[model samples]
Target: MTNRTRTPRTRYAQSLICLLFVWAVMGSNSALAELTIRITEGADAAIPVAVVPFSESEGIPSSDKISSIVQDDLAMSGEFRTLAPEKMLSLPSKRSEVYFRDWRLLGQRYVLVGALNRNGDRVEARYELFDVNREERIMGATAGASANNMRTLAHHISDKVYEAITGVPGAFSTKLAYVTRDSANGEPRYRLQVSDVDGKRAGIRLESKEPILSPAWSPDGRKLAYVSFETGRPVVFIHELASGNRTRIAEYRGLNSAPAWSDDGRSLLLTLSKDGNAEIYRIDIQSKNLKRLTNHWSIDTEAVWDHTGNGFFFTSDRSGGPQIYHKSSEDAEPRRITFGSRYNARARPDNDGKFVYYVHQRDRAFHIAKTDLESGEETVLTRSESDESPSVSPNGRMLIYATKQSGNSVLTVVSADGGDAYSLPASQGDVRDPAWSPILR
Candidate 1:
């Protein structure tokens, strides 16, 4: 894992530039485009889930919207499409109230029911998951939290159900940092935000008139690295949580952006166009020394380190159009990861090293997709007309991507396998360039 280093504060877009790049790379989205996820092969189909309304056992404040939070948590995973309350054939509160036939009619394979018991100063929650098809209880748990901790408890339940059904550790408890740009009357406003993986507890990490881009967390989740234009140009800076001090790590002449931390936090891999064209470079944090990793003249950027931290996956136009490529420190040759997508592709490595999530372009829009780096299988994760900048969670079970809804940019998290998917409604402005943080307690 990359150990994130703390540095100083700075700056950090919806640009139709991404759309132009999509068309220049892939011929068109209308043609049966090659998907990246299909490269990875079969993921257990998105679990058909039904989370029954939760029960309140205790006298906790009735104002705590716990159930709503849990639903958001599960719905964002993308591996399970939650059955809406309106679509559910039955809403069971207890095991006896659960009629397999009623749930079956709703096309649900798994069901969850929960209740909250009010503790003196805290609350206790008991939740259960049922394998409706098998007529058996799959799992159950009891959790306690203060009123303010309701969202955290909801995440816990989601993590449990996700692991039980997918056999992969759930990342629902993680956090997300993304950039939002609100443009009104040709004037642009930018904000950097940190939100729960389920879109809760969102706090403004920093805001500025200049754009703030690429919000990445330290491995320990105590700091951030991003590019800011506050100084009139793009500069990469590191921010420490303890002191709120920001350090400028990279400030080249032409372009200094797209910062990614190495697994050990010893170095940063980013894109620099100072050498005439956008290329990848690795910088040692301690020595302040930079080593040019890619010497390509055709735009090469968005370098993502693999799970081992010894290698990276990036996007490049060396093949004519943007495509995903893997480069390891041990090898001089860069290997191509995506073959089907022509328009555009960005590599998002899973924590488990099983797959690489990416964006695939179709027609004139971009879609979130993933590929099995080993099997060469690909699957599409979203059907949205314009979606990009997918960020994988620390556990590799889910992804967060930027989407444009009603002409406004927003952040959406989805299970890596395409289970639950929903938008993180922007409280202040539009959102984009989401970067998921590694687990931080």
Candidate 2:
């Protein structure tokens, strides 16, 4: 019994050492930063708003300024145009200090004011959202966070402000899962990282010398399913973010890749070549029971569940070139969905199943495009040269994908309607295979 106890301690120490090494390597290299967001172009009709600078009380640290991060989050969404502190006529941190007439003259539609107060070890933010035209406080709340988690508190405030105005839940507090490649030390090193949606405070969830791809977040956003080549052959592993634990869910003969979580989070739809050709199969996560969904000799992969949970949309090369296809059920036959492009694959539908987005080939250049399920109209959404792996935001307002610019691969987020776009580039390496986490309630 003593020996068994010692063995568990030894394993815990080894795991801790591995994590320390990962954080050390990541910290020493500033180029491996949490993504830096750059708004390439903004929407023409963005809502005009002002986020007043938050006044901090004495004895509290700046510890990631709350107001600045909140402003950036709202601006990055392409939904709001936030006024700078310098341009504001008055810096008000409370309702009593706000002047409605001055804000009306500035042509602002809405204004957010807040102040940070420190009590003991916790920092609390007292914030209010108001409509300039109506001269009413639309929302008010107090949110607190630990001293080390000010960024999270700021994002939470952003989410609240967003939901109150847009009627859609703010995805600012949600996380993003992506793969970054850094070969600075001669041999290549890959890291699977999760960070805030605005790209701050990123932490490596997994590190390897091998390649990692196709990170899909579970419905609850607590776990990530990705393809790792750590075992010589490709295998799909489900990794829990809170704990550094992972389980190899699929390792078949030819290919076990492109793991897509179902809406209920009970199973995953993956591509496997064990049965002869690349085909789509569903495996119950706990029971490990396999069910084949597609038997096509052509490639049938990149499957994603529709919001309805009754059907799925996937990519296939059945119609000579790759195109989008949808199946209402397991036994239902797939019908082609994309007709405009010769190569359109990786279909990701919005939460309401209104638009299906994919990588589209236009004028010999790859761009991200979406097709309206109701109107049967397809509109190209990106202007980049090579864009792929599009992942939609939880609110269906924005979608992110991997694109190449200036010889480096960067992640770009564009408005769902192709109105505005921004790029998140690493300081040194290539960032790709972005999967936006679902909104955690």
Candidate 3:
């Protein structure tokens, strides 16, 4: 009996050590994930773009190419259809060399050109944006950063170009957190990970022998809240990244999961099944006081807080087959947000609180969708067989979700307006339950 007790302790210590060591070293080296293109649902049209190969201004080698990365980033947004240089009448490196008439004949609306040179410890990049129809250079900028920082610069350029065209802030600079599962020796393992907006830098933040679900990042991007079954029962844990400290937020007798952090990072709104029925609950982070928000006798989980912190949107089966309902802190009466679907509904509000996004499963296929809360108009964003757990970008103009493509679970990103669709291959395991972190600086 004593030997058996020692064995359990020894196994737990090994697991903890492994988890800590892997997480601590995750940020040291970033690895790029391979890109996989997929067709998106509800795509209206693709914008036409022309990107000529960059020019060389200074005495720099010819091998440090960045235009390819920029092209991939823009194409993945699902909004832009890139024009091949082979199809171009002329490859222009400077504004003077551009033949506006040739591009206009190709139905191109915009054109991009750039120059690159090696700086002291970084690469100097300069790019220009032009309006093909007007024959005008609308925007121009310069950036200088280390070679290792090229990816960051490319994302910034994407943000600028996206914003210039859409009249909304682009979310290309954001990051995504998600859940991945692995099977080894007939046992299942789960891990929580974070990656770049384009699905690069895939690294694990936490791992468990049991299931880990519903990962939500704090508004400040310093912490994460998730449900882990490490203790043989579902519980909520808040993990701080900088200090490597983890604190148990909930370990009640029944279900304690689906943690969603408030916009201000002051509290967490989660679902607890302690009262015999799954219901939404809000817990103050500082005081640790628990407040039962919904008294409904139906299953209510996956609570998402409003940007104002005055209300939250969640899913409940009260009306049969999960539907979305909005509950206000000012009043206990819940208002229904989704009225179309009869099978499943999960609400994920944008950062600005102007839109409420969700997943609608119809005819055995799940799609990412959204509702204009003010207009009550529903738009289906994805038409895939399975797309779930969407997290909106910081600017709320883009989203990342988990989907099955070619029989493999992978992470996919699409414009919030449902434009471009692309996938990120998992470096280690099958990925799911993606959550985008709020911008942190």
Which model scores highest in lDDT?
A: 2
lDDT of 2 at 247: 96
Residue 437 displacement (Å), model 1: 2.4
TM-score of each: 0.78, 0.92, 0.84
Off by over 4 Å in 1: 1-52, 81-111, 132-137, 183-187, 362-364, 375-381, 414-420, 425-428
Model 3 Cα lDDT, one tens digit per residue, 1-441: 377654643454344334433422222112222333443432458788887777766755444356766777778777788887788888777789888998999999999888888777688889888999999998889987786677777777777888888787666677777766766565666767777777766677787767777788998898989888788767799999778699999998767878988767899987776665577888998888988988765667778877777888988877866888897762668999887678556688876767898888777788888988898898888767777788887877678887776766677787888765677756545777778877656
Pick out the ten consecutive residues of candidate 2 with the lowest summed lDDT: 21-30
Q: What is the lDDT of candidate 2?
A: 0.85
Q: What overall lDDT, based on C-alpha atoms, would model 3 receive against the true structure?
A: 0.75
Q: How many backbone clashes does candidate 2 have?
A: 0
RMSD of each: 9.0, 9.9, 8.0
Which residue pairs overlap in candidate 3's backbone?
A: 78-420
The candidates, ranked best first by lDDT, are 2, 3, 1
List where candidate 2 sits over 4 angstroms from the true fold: 1-33
Best by TM-score: 2
Per-residue CA lDDT of candidate 1, range 274-357, in tens? 755677899887887988888764567888788888888888877878899888662568988888768657678887688988
Per-prediction backbone clash count: 52, 0, 1
TM-score of 2: 0.92
Model 1 residue 158 distance off true place after TM-score fit, in angstroms: 1.7
lDDT by candidate, in order shown: 0.72, 0.85, 0.75
